[model samples]
Target: MTRLQRLVRIAWVFCKYRLDIFLPMAELPAPLKLFFLFAPWHLFPKGSLDRGDRLRLALEELGPVFVKFGQILSTRRDLLPDDMAESLRRLQDNVPPFASATARQIIEDSLGRPVTELFAEFSRDPLASASVAQVHAATMPNGRKVVVKVIRPGIDRVIRQDLALMFMMARLLERYWSEGRRLHPVEVVEDYQTTIYDELDLQREAANASQLRRNFNNSPLIYIPAIDWDHTTKRVLVMERISGIPIADIESLRAAGVDLKVLAEKGVEIFFTQVFRDSFFHADMHPGNIFVDASNPADPRYIAIDFGIVGTLAPDDLSYLARNLLAFFRRDYRQVAELHIQSGWVPPETRVNEFEAAIRTVCEPIFERPLKDISFGHFLLRLFQTARRFNMEVQPQLVLLQKTLLNVEGLGRQLYPELDLWSTAQPYLENWMRKRIGPSGLLRTLQTRLPSWLEQSPEMPQLVHDTLVQLRNAGAPDRGDRQAAITAELAQRHADRRWRLTLGALSLAALAWLGAEEKLVPLAQNMPHYGWALLALAGWLVLKPGRK
Candidate 1:
């Protein structure tokens, strides 16, 4: 269908199901409200469903990309209203598969081999169907059982069109919504586009799967199925077939006598291991993409599928995120606030004390309960809500991480309610932190780069001599223009440093305010007061020096 026709079809589906009813009647513009009331027959047909249900239906009808978007939004209870978040959480990945003949054609064309030649058996029926691709059971000629995943035919055109609409909606949102600027709807959509479109290429997904599999090479906690490189192509992937109970099929898992608690705790470990140890995580970790092997009931193993969407944090982002998470757990609101500024996630000019106080208000209540009792998802939501008050812009990269975390947390909770996420994650993070920053990390880096260093050492003397000569010539007073340029650069750098310091101070103040709520040790409480008084005392110290 043409992009326009697809949009029209979506609109018609919404109208037929009365999706507008879910929207707040009073909050909408007067004209839109009036139009909804007066043009019910034209905009919404009779016997319509609940507005939330209708919206879900319309998105599903639209296509996989839109449905995937809905799934991502569901994780952001922080950004969305309660009703919408709840409704969107119901967006399932199960969609009708393309014809078996179509799947055959895609595989044959991509691999340049007939199905009969490639596989001993290729099932006509799909094992499962999702928005991005469908899986069909097959056996390699070598007698290895595998699953062939074929990208849905014509999905790219649909995704591009839906993405265009998403951008348009994002622009409208930024123009109209009160929270648009803070929420950064357009950036969020753009991030989603990059993520979903990347999933369209089976080659990329296969590589991601291979890397993750290698990371956990001999690990018992998680299993990533081997990719059949010989049969894999840009549009078609052949992977080792795995047999396990779906992670969400609790009844079946229970019937198979899987150790639920071990399974749950292991899930948390697997996530931390992937993110902190491997620095690569499977971002799309919805229940459908996860399974559990109950073969060894005492030691349950997690089986992961759908490696299409994954995320990695930048070094700076990883450091700041770790500090923020640690600070929040310790109820050190000031540290959290300072970290945000230091990380540049929030504007540097924000007052640290005020931000700190806001964070304390949002987090203290949650801390009153045990980590097991606290809802990690709700905690994030509240944190974001508090951040919005301080003009904090949403971090699009963190959005995927947050969504995946929520899914993992939810799955863990369902399997084991008493699971202490803080306890489970803290040790892993601490170990990672130590290895990342301490002597061990330096040693590891040295070891890894030793060969290259040895290879380049022979040329180092000449390189250093040449560099020193350039520096000496550049510093020569005969070059007055060079001196002037150097001076100007230094001055600009100084100004930038001052601005950064101011931002640092502001962030610190926000953190102090947030951390002050807990009965701080008397000394810590007096520190801020002392710091303030020292500013006043600085003039006297300077005057004394001047008089002397």
Candidate 2:
């Protein structure tokens, strides 16, 4: 169907669902408010429905792109009120599955092979279905069980039409809204475009899964199923079939004798490890995509599915982020405020003290409660609200990370109420911070480059000789005041080189000191009450205390 036809169909669905009744007519725009007085729009159902429900219904009615947009928006609890966020969170892609025959045809066309030849058993019945894709259980010739995921037939057309309409709306919003600059509606739409397009490509999702699997290979915390590459295609993915109780099915997990506390603590540890160690995280970690492998009830491992949406932070972002979290943990609101400005997450002109006060107002109360009791999602929301006061535009990417983190945090807490997230995460972040800013990191860098430097050592003398020859040939004798000038220049160069070498060596020693700190402490303890004399002897050589 055409785009306009689709939009009209959407409007009809909204009306048929009696969505208008849920909205407050008086609070809407003047155009919509006036429309409420007319025929079909005026025939509103009388009930207890709310604005949040109305918004959710309207987006769902608008079809997949709109529904997905709502899903993305639902993650930005920082932007939405509690009720609205709660309502939108229910917008799951539970639409009817496309025909199994059609899915087989798609796989055949994309991979140029018949289904019978590829799999020992290909079930027509869908294992699970969603708007974009559906899966079917199958087995390979080698007797390896796998699940084949196929893209829904004709979805590209549907998605394209809806995305075009979304872009149009975003453009209109940018043109009309007074807060357009701050909102950056066009940029938001652009980001959504990139994300949706990435989702459209199953290969990208497969690669993401592969990378995540590699990151946690043989780890006991999380399990990402292996991708069956030989049977996989662009439109069809064949992956290891996973069996676990759904995370949402709390009763099943409880009945299976799972240790909720250990499970919850593991969840927290996994998140920190992904963020700090891997730097790549699964951004779409909703309960539906999470499952619990309770085979080992004492130590439950999480099974993660749906790799279509993931997020990674730049190194600089990760560094700044570590500091940001540490600052928040320390209750140094001013430093947090300054960091935001320095990192350019917030505009530079924002007053540090004022921002600090605003942040303190938002965060100080949360500290009154235990860290587990404090909702990371809610805290982020309040922080964004405070940021909005200072005209700080939101980072669309960070919103996804924040949303996924909140889901993980919420799920963990629900499983184990006693889980102290702060306590579990604090040490991880602290260790990461120390490595990033301390001596061990410097030593690692030096060690990584040392082999290459050794390989190039033979070329250094020749390089120096060539440099001196070029300088001399340029005009050594003809230059006026040449000798004296060259002498002065050499003195300056020598001083500069001396300082550079000093700083470099100091950094190396600092890293070594950090590495040896624990070992050195014991050695110092055993130093026969004369450690001061040893230090004095070493200091005299390095510092030349006799030289003024």
Candidate 3:
């Protein structure tokens, strides 16, 4: 459809759903408010559907891309009202599969082989279909079972067209809506564009699955199916077929005697492990992509699929995130606020005391509830809202992490309503922090860099001599007296370099020792600043004034 036609249809859907009633008419200009009065949809009687349902219906009617957008929005419980968020959560990506004949043709054309030649048996009917792709049951010649994932034909064209409409709408919202600039509608759309386009590449998805499998190799907590690389391609992926009950199938899981509480706790552990331990996590961890292996009912494991979208955090982000969560668990609002500023998540100029107070106000009441009664998703939402007052910019890289956390939390609660997320996660965070910042961690870092240090060791003496000479002669004039001054300056610089290096090494060693004792938690918390201090000191000593 043409962009103009699509826009008209969207407007019609809005009016038909009586969405105007949900808007704050008092806040809108009189002229625009009057436009709603004359809107043709007003001629029809108001339906029984609520605003949330209406919104979901409108998106579903728009197309697969719109439906997918709603699915994403559903995860942002912090941004939307409870009713709307709940309603959108039900937006499923159950689009009808494309023609089987067309699918077969594409497979043949892409692989340059007939379906029968590639597989011992290929199912014509799709086992499942989503907006971007569909999975079909197939078997290899060796009698091993697998699934063929095919990207929807011409999906890129459709996505680009819808994305153009989305961008146009986002621009309109930014221009006309008061909250648009704060929300950053354009950036959000661009992020979604990048994510959805990434999902179009099956090869990327295969790599994600392989890496995850390796991360959890032989582990009992989670199982990632093996990718059949020989048969995989950019447009198609073949992976070991895994059979298990859907994670949402509570009845089936219970029937199999799976421990719901343990299962729920494991979900949280898996998420933390993926985010903090491996730094690579499945971003699209909705129930549809998750399954429960009940072979051992006492210790159920997660079987994950559809790794098209994944997330990774930088080292600083990972460290700060772990510390923040640990602080939150301890109800250390002050530490949490400090971490935010230290990590540059909020502006450096933000007042730690005031931010801490605000966080306390928002979090204290939530703590009154029992662990099982609290929702991490809502807590994060409240935290985000509070951070906004300090002009905290959204971290786009962390969006997927946030979304995956919501999914994990939701799925955990669904499995066992009484799950103590805090208790389950606190120890994990504490352990991760210790391993990351403790003496052992320092030793590990040193071990990893030892080779490089040794490789450059031979040049160190020359480097030191050259640095001293440069510092001594930096502003010395070419004269007889200057020659003696330069020599004296060189000797002084050499002495200063030794002392500076000694002090720096001692400071780091002391820090590591204190970290081992857990006495340097506060120091570790402020490690970023200490790092900069060390760097500045090293630079100053290397260029400090000498006898000259």
Q: Give the number of the best model, judged by lDDT.
A: 3
Residue 338: error of model 3 in Å? 1.8
Winner on lDDT between 1 and 2 is 1
- Window of ten residues with lowest summed lDDT in model 1: 539-548
**How many residue pairs clash (N, CA or C atoms closer than 3 angstroms) in each of the candidate models, in the order given?**
11, 2, 0
> Which portions of model 2 show Cα errors greater than 4 Å?
10-48, 447-548
- For residues 1-548, what per-residue lDDT tens digits would candidate 3 score against the true structure? 67678778877887778777755556668897898678787776779998799899988888889898888777665456779988998887889999988888888888889999999999989999999999999999999999999989988888888899889878877776776776777988898898898899999999999999999999989999999998888898999999999999999999999999999999999999999899999999999899999999999999999999999999989988888998898899999999999988888999999999999999999999998899998899889989988888767877889899999999999999998888888888888888888777876685466445434543555676666666656755653466756566566556656655654574467556777778777755775774656446554544555433
Per-residue lDDT of 205 in model 3: 93
Question: Which residue runs of candidate 3 sit more than 4 Å off their true CA positions?
Answer: 20-48, 450-548
Candidate 3, residue 161: Cα displacement in angstroms equals 0.7
Where does candidate 1 stray beyond 4 Å? 17-51, 445-548
Superior by TM-score: candidate 1 or candidate 2? 2
Query: How well does each candidate superpose onto the true structure, as a TM-score?
Result: 0.79, 0.81, 0.83
**Ranked candidates, highest lDDT first:** 3, 1, 2
lDDT of 2: 0.78
Q: Give the least accurate 10-residue stretch of model 2, judged by summed lDDT.
A: 539-548
